[model samples]
Structure formats: C-alpha cells, structure tokens
Target: MTSRDTDATTDATTDAAAREHATATTAATGPAATAADAPVTISYEEIDGARIAVVSLNRPAKLNGLTMAMLRGLDDAAATLRRDRDLRGVIFAGAGNSFCAGLDFGSVLKKPMDIVKAFAPNPLAGDGANLFQRVCWEWRRLPAPVIAVVHGHCYGGGVQLALGADFRVTAADARWSVLEAKWGLIPDMSGARTLADHVGAEQARWLTMTGRELSGAEAVEVGLATETTESLDDAHSRARETLRELMGRSPDQLAATKSLFNHAWRSPRATFRAERFEQAKLLLSENAARARTAAMKKTPPNFVRRGTWAFGAKKK
Candidate 1:
C-alpha cells in the first residue's frame, strides 16, 4: 500500500479504538461518566508550617452525589494521605452547595457487577472492609486527625463519612439525615459502627429508623456533629482553627489519642493498656522533649516531623 494509505488506515484504527474504549466505559459506568462527574479532588495547604490535606467532592451540580468513581476516589485519597508523614490534619468538604446527597443509585445501579465488586471484602488488607466501607473507615485509620465540614445536604453515606472523622463541624442551618431508610435501605457504609461511638443506642436507632432530617444545631444536640457555625465560611474557619490548636500539640500524641479512642474506647482494660503503651513511647520521643523544653522556656515548640505509628489492629 502507499505510505499515505497506510497513514490513513492507522488513523482510522486509532479512532475506532478510541470510540470502542469510550463506548465500553459509558456502558460500564452509565451516563454519569462525564467530565463533570470527576469524583473527588485532593489538595494540600501549608497552614502555619503544618501540611493539611483537603479532600473535596467535586459533583456540585448534583449536590455532590456519591458514585462508584467517587467512592474509589475517596479511598484513594485516604490511602495517599496515609503515606504522608508530614500530614498534620485532613478536612473533608464538598465543592458546591451540598456535602453529599448520598449514593447516586441511578448511576451505580446500572452496573450490577460493579456493585458486587464494591461490596466484596479486600482479600489482601484483611481489614474486612468493602470498598464502600473503606472510603469512610480509612479516615479513622489515618495517623493525622480528620475533620468533616458539613454545610448543605448530608445524607446517608455523607453522614457516615462525617462520622468517620475525628470531628465534624457543620453550618448551623445545614440539613443532616440518616436517609437510608427513606430509600428502604440501611446504612452499610460503616455508619452502623461509627454511629454507636457518638450517640446512645436509642438515639442511633431513632435516626436510622426514621431517617428524619436534623438541623446542624439539632445534630450537635443529638451528638451527630461536634459543633455548628452560623455559615459555611464560619464552619470552615472553625475547622481550621481547631486544626491550628491541634497543631500546637505533638502529632504523635494526637495520633495515639485517636487510635486509643477509636479502637479501645469500649474496653477499659484495652484502653488502659494502650494508654500506657502509647504514653511510654511519647514520653521518650523527641517531640515530647521539645514540648517540655518550650514550656519551660515559655516559647513555641518546634517539633520534628511526625512518625507513622500503627497502634491497633485494623477494625471494621
């Protein structure tokens, strides 16, 4: 064949392959496979010389509804943050008006096999967490503290996501709900586990069964939120301020405390044992010495970079 003919054929082949790949992706993920549906975004900001990670859900037009891609994005973000020893804190937020309106069932239900894959446990990690659960649970496992800033609609999986954080600061007027009941479903996204840590069994049952919406103030009253602010900006500011305060302390202690509460809270013996173990390590660390020297000299503590310490076995 002529060189021009060969070039033309190659171009056509590439075009056909592109079309086939696009068609396959669309079929697998449904119509939600658009540029606008670009799941989650992660960025780092150096605040007061401490590196803080911010994870934002990018689907604002649909109220940041959760999709399979978004779930994987969240999991990936958590994994990335876990590896960063310099990370002091993390903030989870929504890009637009709402935090998240729960799972995008219409988009996800299109692929039954994807749902099955998401529901299956991770064989290698031995954590007993499926993809849906890991997206939330991984936040609890990170050495750095996580705070969820809730503003608009936070329902179903969104609520679970916030619960996974060490703290949740919400806009006073934001709507919060355990909305799984509304869809004739239960929260399978680790909400069942985290919710118990915050509230009483009766209260947990009421919220899960009724799926009643609560204002930010009400959420705080019922133990769903750490605190509420008058506006979205205020909520974020409060979260940042809290992180700044946390930055003043030793990162190792903060990590140890999180692990203690998350893993050993329900067992007094375990809590005591963990406290002693973690305290022994912290007391002998350089950061603790810096804290002591700074306190004695009445100067700010200049701590060394944090160490990644694994305290407990992975929990579901």
Candidate 2:
C-alpha cells in the first residue's frame, strides 16, 4: 500500500545506471532499496535510478503471465516504493520476448467461477486496493509517473497491466488483444477499471466482449499504446529519448503536473460518469457471466460492430 523514498546520490551515477539498464529505472541504486532488501521469491530485476525505480516482471516461459508469486513480488516492489523523496518516477517492463501474456492459464482455470461471481460492493479490500487494479494502479499511485515498454504479445491482463503505466512504448509488430472473453474471463486485472481511463467505454466493451485481435499500431489508435518501434531495442531507445525530455523538467514542476493528470480520471470528475455506472452494471450482471462463461470454452464471443453499439446483432 505504501512505498519508501529512495536515497540520494550523484545524479550522474543514477543517469549512467538508467542508460545501462535501458528498461530499468534509476531509483534502484538508492537507499530506498532497503525496502527491496526483503527476501523474495521469483525472478525479478531491480535497477536503481535517481528519479525512478525500474521493475521487471521475469517469467518469460509463461510470457510473463502473472501468478500469486508474481503478485507478491509486485507487492514488494510497491512496498519498496513507499514514501520518500529524491525519486521522481517508476518504470516497468517484462523480461524475455514478451512483456506479459496476462494471468497464467492454470490460475484462471482454478477459479473459473470467479468471473461469474458478483464483484463485491468494493473491489479494493484489505489493502484498500485490488490486485487487478494494482497491476496498473500501483504504477499510477506512485508519486511519480510509471513508464512501460511493451513488446511482442500484450493481451488481456497484459494490456491491463500496462494500462497502469503513465506512458507506454511498444513494438511495431506486437500482437495485442483484450482476450479475457476468449478464455471465459473478464479483464479483472484492472483492465475494466482502467480501460476507459484512456479509451472510452464503448471502445473498451467492444474489445472486451468480442475479444478481437489488435496490433501495436492499432493500440496507439485505441489509446492502449503510445507509440510503436521496430523492435525492443528501438523501443528502449525512444524511452530513453523521452526520459531525456523528462530529465529537463524541474522535479517539483514535473511532479505537480503528473499528480494533476494522474487523478484526472477521478470518478465524480471524469467525463465518463454516465458510462461508469453502466460499466458497474455489467460488472455485476448475469449477462456478463453468461458471456464470460461461453468465452472461456474457447467459443467465439459476439461483439459490437466497430462504429456501431450493437453486440451480436445482425449487421444493419
């Protein structure tokens, strides 16, 4: 729920580290690392940054599918981010060929019924946050901005996961999809909440319900992605180039601007006030359960037409 502040050191050192790691941030090398010192399981990378802490989700075999273990790691990473000064941002990326494939197939299969169950009146519980939201929310909650570099397949939970980051740079050919419906699931990993944060509700539903495929290029159009690069190498380069722009800003000025924009989607204040209610309706609807259940069977789910609001209805 809380993260510690990182220690201060020569900006030159942190800058060099950030450049070297490419995907990692400069916060890792600071005294804030004390929080990260905890004994941990699972493979992860921590890069110290003067203004950011870069965290990498390491299980390439599953395409970085999140597991309970990975969740715990994320918790630790968030904890390490608790209050302190000096650090200005956080960055996240996945290890290996893919950014994240979403939740592992076995994890989803274990509680096939959860998707149909009514979401509690509150999605945020014990931690005052939900794991699904934490996937992207944790990154958003930081006092700083979170930058994500996505490549390869960014689908379902994976895309939702990236939704948490403030900015994202992806690969040109990366394959993306909402896909939860295809697997009899919903974008519980914070996708539902954050989907409209960038893209609007209608677009979000069409993607979630139908589970159509998307390319990295389309992602930019849909607002799920920021820009596309030819490869990971280029993606990182652009990230650094963007970072250079960030580095020029006064830390205080940048922080304030980020904070203002971070909560720009505040419920009462967000423009989707009307759609938010409808979305909540669907989240708890029986129709959602039936639709999700069918998709899990690998059945082809019906979706609304791209420009039309019709779901499964005959072409007009």
Q: Per-residue lDDT of 44-114 in model 2, one digit per residue for the tens?
A: 23322344556766655556676555665675676676453455555577666677776665654466545
TM-score, every prediction: 0.83, 0.65
The runs of at least 3 residues in candidate 2 whose Cα sits more than 4 Å from the true structure, single-residue gaps closed, are 1-51, 107-127, 267-316
lDDT of each: 0.76, 0.59
Q: What is the lDDT of candidate 2?
A: 0.59
Candidate 1 local lDDT, 119-209, one digit each (tens) = 9988887568999999988999998999998987888888999999999999998899898887677888888888878887788999999
* Candidate 1 collision pairs: none
TM-score of 2: 0.65
Clashes of 2: 21
Best by TM-score: 1
